[model samples]
Target: MATTNSLLLGFLLLHIAIHHSVPVEGHPNYSDALAKSILFFLGQRSGKLPPDQTMTWRSDSGLSDGSTANVDLTGGYYDAGDNVKFSFPMAFTTTMLAWSILEFGGKNRMSGQLSEARAALKWASDYLLKAATQTHGKLYVGVGDPNSDHACWERPEDMDTPRPVFSVSSTNPGSDVAGETAAALAASALVLQSQNRTYALKLLLAAKDVMDFAMQYRGKYSDSVWTACPYYCSYSGYMDELLWGAAWLHKATKNATYLNFINSLGANDITDIFSWDNKFAGARVLLARKTLVDKENSFDPFRFQAEDFLCRILPNSPSKTTQYTPGGLIFKLSSANLQYVTSITFLLNTYAKYMASSGHTFSCQNVLIKSSTIRAFAKKQVDYILGQNPLGISYMIGFGTFYPKMVHHRGSSLPSISSHPAHIGCNDGFQYFFSGNPNPNLLIGAVVGGPDQNDAFSDSRTDYNHLEPATYINAPLVGSLAYLAGRYGSG
Candidate 1:
């Protein structure tokens, strides 16, 4: 009996030594720092924005106010029965910022920014926790302001209800809730674990439950919903949310169920929803490449399809160029659609990694522009902003045609007005248009211009100086500028 026990002990020690010695797969330089930053930040903080930055944007108070400060509008307009307001877009922004901070830490450890990153993580986590608590496990994806009547369904009046000041619509109900919540919780769990917080395990378990619940509601092919309209379907958003959640869960728990879920989703046909207007399809493809990189299973057809779709959109030649002008400043779109700084950055950073691993390139013409170009564009945009006065940079430009076009309202008995010209502006351009004809849906925000211009402006020429500081227009603009500044730093 003694000899048998000794043999078992020796085998167990050998197994442990081997496991410890093996380098973990997917150990990218950025991932380690990201993990550390997220863990540290979560352990140290809780609800509320850090004491440094003040919320200067407009508030959505009173019947006359049409804007909500610091919030992104997803499901616009609301009425009665829909008493809840979904704040997923705002939630998403927070999640992305938190993820960005962690990812950035993985690559470059900027000293002073650690606190800012920590603050962002804390703010986002609090927001998510509050949302979860408010919903009480019943997912309310976004928040709505009172003015916009809920037109999400056929009968807006029937669903109208007075609850919070914000509006809640069923249009794109809970599409990203599960994925986003999972990401927030996963990040928090990682942050807490690193600090040796006793509750880290519990947070992780809770996060897993949220993720599982979300997965259960994913569409037939495992694609996530953006809204009730099929056109609003998002490719990259869902995939990123899912992969990030799954990857973190797998890493933390090593559970085969999560791995299997990822594989099943990967194998499904997700490209049927692709459209030219949104680059979400492209983004999803890139995300899929990231998710499938180290998997042992044969490369999924959807993964290849995603690559093929990207190839279809690629400019014919690397040398070919397009032009972009915004706020009267002209720039060259040397890489076609690849000009969008964030999109290009994601492609190069992610797709390039995939190319290196697969020993395959998506054709020479389709190769992502180098990281240098992305950095250059970001820098140029930053320079333009710094050159202008704070208010001068307030405009937001609308890009694709799918974004609503401005229509002049005559204020006739028929209700609202229609038939406005479709105009594109620079990143800073802002335009207000109805969500639908006859009745105003809600004013939505969009970024304009093709890939090359450094100038950002609104589609309209009117001076917005008279607009209230607390207006909705200012909040997103502020957030966008803040995001851009963070990405490129003050030039």
Candidate 2:
């Protein structure tokens, strides 16, 4: 008991120190942060590099991704610091990016990140299209072996590791991954409608086919692709994804079939999160719009659930499920906590607009709160991520003068090909992974797994739980940063 208490006391004292040497502020160049966040994806890019590839550090990688499956599975963002291309999170990344564009695209343009954001969205969407269509009634859920890839720390550029492709067919259905891909296609279609109407329509139609497959052959992708377990497993079940995909289909196509399916879903549980694994919260948010725009009686449950989700996440609400740190960061799971922060902040921005445009107010524990409050709370959280915390460091790489230098991304850690022509062998890369030095290449815009419950951060490459960056982490943040920059910041 004394030891535990002593440890606790020591932690408290150290936390109070709060890295005072590191200067920090509430806001610093939101536009710059937005741009860097978009650039982060370039570092995670796999397969062939384009001529205009800005992240010159990352060259062509995983070119023969789907060669094992005899299908082209090149050109998608890596799941995280690793080279393995997990399709579930990749689809969620696309869906969130598209949703951001659909909501705050103008703000993104004002902040001078619209084109990059569009390209980022297209980059993932194009791969999603190929994933769903290339398999011929089958869905390619993942590429590369997680166990082997994780064991070796080499950069994707020279991946000598096994490039096994995993897919789910009618016999082995993966509703979760397929549904997510469908959602990605639908949302991307809406976002890219102006850029290429014909392509957008093609995406919408493909979304329909994939969504139908998900509904027709119902099963979890994790079940089919067992290797994905303990990584990107489907925790909340496949129904949430099906409903999410159906909602996006309705939004894009406005087909009565989709509307009927959503109304039939009858998911009343207020989702606690919107992340790579769970889609319930996102489904509620999207379906809520149906009642607002169409004034449909069938969609009232979704609106109620969506409102409940907001109330549950708010600090003032009696039913609040999300916990906040002393530094005002949204503290959820102990690991990769920033994923929830980004997801919820995006939803708050989206739902806040919905409430403001409709002049609607909701009762949180019978206390009617203004939509502005949610937006304000969201800003505080975003500001906390940029800085304004006890740690006084930006979780986002390249956002501030002092940020994460030891991001747990393999490409960022290894010496760039330009700098060192000598190849770092497979296991040899672990030396860099464990090194205390900063990564050789800057993973700009990459949002790392964030601080602990006490708003403490470890700037160690070995501490992947708190230092690794991901594509999904940056996807939802694009619009939030863009909106803040447009509405408030000079940059």
Best by TM-score: 2
Best by lDDT: 2
Candidates' C-alpha lDDT: 0.37, 0.85
lDDT per residue, candidate 2, 1-491, as tens digits? 99999999977766543453222224557777788888888888888999999889889988888999899999998989998999999999999999988888894343567888999999998898888888678888889888998999998887898889999889999999989999999999999999999999889888999999998998988888977788898888899899899989988887899878876777565677788888898888888876766667677878888888888899988888888988888888988899999998999988887888878788988877787998899988887788767767888887755588998889999998888778888999988888888898988889999999988887888888999888888899887887788776643
Model 2 residue 43 CA deviation (Å) reads 0.8
Cα RMSD, each candidate? 19.9, 5.5
The runs of at least 3 residues in candidate 2 whose Cα sits more than 4 Å from the true structure, single-residue gaps closed, are 1-26, 107-110, 293-298
Per-candidate TM equals 0.48, 0.94
Per-residue CA lDDT of model 1 for 1-491, tens digit only, reads: 99999999988866653443311221112222222222222211212213342321111212222124223222222211122233433344344444444434332343444554555445555445544444334444444332332322212212222333232223223434566566556666665465546656656766677677566655311132223223223434455456546655665577888767766665333332221112344335434554456554443544565555444333433533323354322243332221233333333334444545565444435455433333344334422322221223311212111221321211110111123222222211122222233223212222222222443323221211111011111111222233333443432
